[model samples]
Target: MRESLRLLRDELSRINSPDELSSWKERFEELLREAVEKKLGVKCRSPVYLFKTLYHAGFINREELDALLQFDELNDPSFFERLLERLETRL
Candidate 1:
């Protein structure tokens, strides 16, 4: 596992293009989501609670959360709750 991580780190260091980096970022996010699902026994696709938990844990960054929720509010609890309700309805 350490060897694999070392290799991955070396490869990441050599990546130069935005397109390539973006591809890698997507893959890493998918891997993290899969691990989270496996550990929590929840399908992360439609679970706002799980996503919020991850965000609070710093496992998911603000930019990633914004993309998922289409929300930009940082400290507005009421607004965030409303958005979560709206998004849940869309599911």
Candidate 2:
């Protein structure tokens, strides 16, 4: 789990465009689900809750949290909504 989070952090730091988000979001959600369902043994609603749960569990640190926060929210809200809308259409 630690290794998974580390890989996520590294990949997150490299992402600088929307071209990367769809794939990255899938990996992030999968890892969060693994951490919550297996490691932490709980259900998670949103990514924020999953990450904060991991942070409190010591699976993630402050810097990692900041990286995740920036990745998740440092953008116009509609941009992400549109991205997710488009992504959902493929399902």
Choose the strongest candidate by lDDT: 2
Which tens-of-lDDT digit does each residue in 1-91 have in candidate 2? 6566556656666777775765777776776666567755788877777767767776556766665566655444343344333323321
Per-residue lDDT of candidate 1, residues 16-63 (tens digit): 776665564454345445656755555677445656756765555676
Give the Cα lDDT of each candidate. Answer: 0.49, 0.60
* Each candidate's clash count: 0, 0
The stretch of ten residues in a row with the least summed lDDT in candidate 1 is 71-80
User: Using Cα atoms with residue i matched to residue i, what is each candidate's TM-score against the true structure?
Assistant: 0.45, 0.53
34, model 1: CA deviation in Å?
1.1
TM-score of predicted structure 1:
0.45
